[model samples]
Target chain A: MSWTMTRKALWDLRWTTFWYALGLALYTLLIAFVYPTFREQSAQFEEIVRNYPEALLRAFGIEPGQGLSSSFGAFMHAEAYGFVWPLVAAIFVIMSGAAAVAQEVERGTAELWLSVPESRPRLLAGKLVALLVGMLAVVGVSVLSLLVAAPLVDAELPADAAAQLGVVLLDFLIAVAGISVLFSSIFSERGKAAALAAAVVLAMYLAWVIAGLSERFEWLRYLSIFTAYRPREALEGSSVSWAGLLALLAIGLGSMLASLAIFRRRDILV
Target chain B: MDSLPIQVNGLTRFYGKTRGVDDLAFTVERGEIFGFLGPNGAGKTTTIRLLMGLIQPTRGSARIFGLDCWRDATAVKSHVGYVPGDARLYEAMTGAQFLDFLAGFRPGIDPARRRMLVERFDVDLSRTIKHLSKGNRQKLALVQAFMHDPPLLILDEPSSGLDPLMQRELLTFLREEQARGKTIFLSSHLLYEVEQVADRVGIIRDGRLVAVATIEELKRQRTRRMEVAFSMPIDLAQLASVDGVQVLQVREGGRWVELGVSDGLPVLLRRLSELPVVDLVYAPPDLDSVFMGYYQRQEAITGERAR
Candidate 1:
């Protein structure tokens, strides 16, 4: 019944979080060592910017006067923090949530847990909290990696950049956790839930990219989760967009509530 | 009208078009060790699940200690202990951790009781559940269920993976728990096991409650077997007319006969006394025969013998 007990129970998956963080660190190293060499040797950047100026610019989100080195770093950040890191974090959050319920049902562990005095809602809430902690840990690792590499790249560690990154990471994590909960409530299979969540995340990312490239289809931006999330603007000293933050939070919390409602009413298979 | 610890009335559940449990109703009075007897797919597990409030019943309702099972599941669970037919633990957790996790949920679990249960079951607490043998895992589950000392215990195949000695120990523990006025609702395919502990037995087949009665009543209703060797040759055809006996077998010499009798065993004995009965053997009905008779009767009534 205690929040602290539930929090500790949620933290039980720390080993999984540790591995994910380690993977993120290794990925950071690979990008730092390999990407700069590609930019120095080839006209890859110029060719990409020229052929599809809007597409390339939208992809990397660089300003007009930014130099190749900084643009390259921004490009790396776009790839890592924007898509790769968020994707990884989202997958982890979804996996954790899906595993929390569906895996227990699959392996018949839920029966044991349910046999106790814990209410269904409290058990579910505890799992959700655990998943949030996992997402937070992933975001923390991304921030740590950026901080470690920023000095090495001669870039000052700005407080605004840190805050922006933190918000983006947290927002993405919440969104994915919500989606995962919804999927878990509907599907008892862990693999199927994770796959469906991944598909949704990818579709949303693609929608955002397509929206940004064409003015004719600007309306599509409203449908994309990534559209409301703008980390770069925040990094450039702009205030965090409260409207976008509120929208994301609403969707996340709403989906989670729907999941709990359904879960309480539905029959558990295992 | 009795103070039944568990009461189910017209309970029904379905999965798509398939019926999981169909109009099941029964009761277990306080301090009674009741047995739910059934075959492989006879809705025994479904009934247990419904009682546990793990699933919603499509029709009617189940209650534990006069509280709605689904609505008051948390309250009921606190006072009830369950061991599923397939007792699977969190494979990632050590045996001790799983026990501790379960213990943390309840308010007043005695550490000494926990220690005593584990020791009695001979379960190793240090190893992860994944690494333990099936028997050990079952023992761990038993320890968990009994450690809290709840008033009502629902076990499905509680002896499935246990060794003979452990099974006996568990049965003894159940007896002691019953002595303390606890109620137990257990389901098992092993009729003998049920016979050892249960005061009342409910037989289910094809998702229907075929019969519910006391063990003595069931035994009384069962066909009694008697083998007799007479000094004088007895006519098999004449013995068939004996009041309560159905001749099952006859030897070529007509000196020995096996009869399946229902009631009037005293009349059969009187008839046997008229002849010089060199040797006679009367055996009480075993559990297997009782189950077979029930299934056969059910098959005839339903006209679907294959299942």
Candidate 2:
């Protein structure tokens, strides 16, 4: 299989991928710029986080006792715009991956594709590579915007902040792509596959937040991808844990392998 | 004929308890046009998928050019071209880009041949496939299948969405390809289309093959229709006594008799000549009727045995 051919296949779905990346970048900027100015005197942000510290903060990754100017900026960039926004951006990436195979089967295009002189695994691998590249492009653009925006906003830029953000985004990308591939194999509808991926991501995110807010739920930390990823610790210039990274890699690879096994055994509906 | 382009032996595929193909066996000799005739749910698509190695068979095996279709799928794929029954294309890509994407996979395809097929099929390469009409999409499929000029072409309902003119053009194209010594395996429900191109046909129903023969042989062994009009009344029982003649209906003051003659049409015609025949119409058996008879026979066999 030619890598150039795989790249060409990626180019076919590039338009939708571009729009999704652009939307994610714009959403990040909006939170970084607009959300802060609006919260200059409002109590809504405080009140929302007070009652549901575990739910609200975990839902949006907002932390309390972080001052308005500095910690608030951190909360916006580190929490909301950092992991939450990428998670949102990853929804599109996952959607693209799910659409790559299941959509073809659903739309009856797999028949046309398989009729050509291409092996089943090679054809499937090409689509998987295309989807992975599309998601990586989105993450690349997000990192570029964050690097450019940090200084102009007068916020303290940690020495390794940009690198730490890159790591977090990479982990999320692999997790999303893997889960998407898994769902794509099982479901014929694009919407259902995407929804299942989102649900899984959200569940993992919530588990991590609970582990962070209370000591009693510390055991649950193992269940969440967030526990394995700590951008704040990384930004403080500490070494990121290898165990969590390995765990994440294992999950991603395991999901992808499961997908491959199922796809090989199951018939193409189209 | 050094090697068969495609061969199958007792191939069976099942989804749970529902059998898609069962004990199916056939062979396509090199440079021959073989037609697979069947109705919907007749295992045509399943057999094609198994041959393409898109799915594995539950039992038996399929071979392409002497290579196992499933085990050596990559090698087999490199030498054959296929057109699926439902020709679906990538909606996001333009026709030109889709063709380009497929062409990139085959290193041996001739660029000149690809261009010629594209032109002959009249597929607009500039437009996105999502926007193309059904006929145009099918044309795009044809261009992809024939562009490579592989040794074997396996097509399932290649003319389903084509108009009459395009269908004729496709027949001409297939004949030309056959002349060039390319084996063709095509499956379709259109009897007339199959009759025009196929040297031999295999009729399948409910995952089983009911009949397989050359076009001429199938029609000859089936039945022929003869309607005779006489200037005067003729005894119907006398016409019925003719060998191979089965009376269907008698009408018009007993002046006309419609008889179905399975074979020995000469004997029936000679017997009719002595009955003061004024006008006569003799017609060979229609392929459609013969094709239907296979299905009816299958239903009767299954239905009666069940009791």
Best by lDDT: 1
Q: Cα lDDT of model 1 overall? A: 0.78
DockQ of 2: 0.56
lDDT of 2 at A91: 73
Q: List the residue pairs that clash in candidate 1.
A: none
**Residues B1-307 of candidate 2: C-alpha lDDT, one tens digit per residue:** 2568989999999988998989988898888999898888899999999998888999999999899988787788877888888787778789988887788777677889988988888889999888999999999989999888888998999997899999999999999999999999989887778889999998888898778889897665565567889998888888788765678778998899877676666777677767799998876445545654454456658999998
Which fraction of the native contacts appears in each prediction? 0.82, 0.65
DockQ for each numbered candidate:
0.57, 0.56
After superposing candidate 2 on the true structure, give the runs of residues whose Cα lies further than 4 Å from its correct spot.
A1-5, A34-54, A62-69, A77-79, A210-217, A235-238, B224-239, B247-261, B264-288, B292-307
Positional deviation of residue B260's Cα in model 1 after best superposition, in angstroms: 4.6
Q: Candidate 2's interface RMSD, please? A: 2.1
lDDT, residue B45, candidate 1: 96
Candidate 2 lDDT tens digits, A1-270: 445447766776688879877877776665656544545644665565466655555545545454222443455554455466766777776777687668878888766666555666566677777776777777677666665655666555564766766676677677777888889888888888888888887788878778767889978888877666655544444577867777777877788778877776667767
Q: Give per-residue CA lDDT, model 1, range B121-199, as digits (tens).
A: 9889999889999999999988899899988999999999899998998899999999998999989988778889999
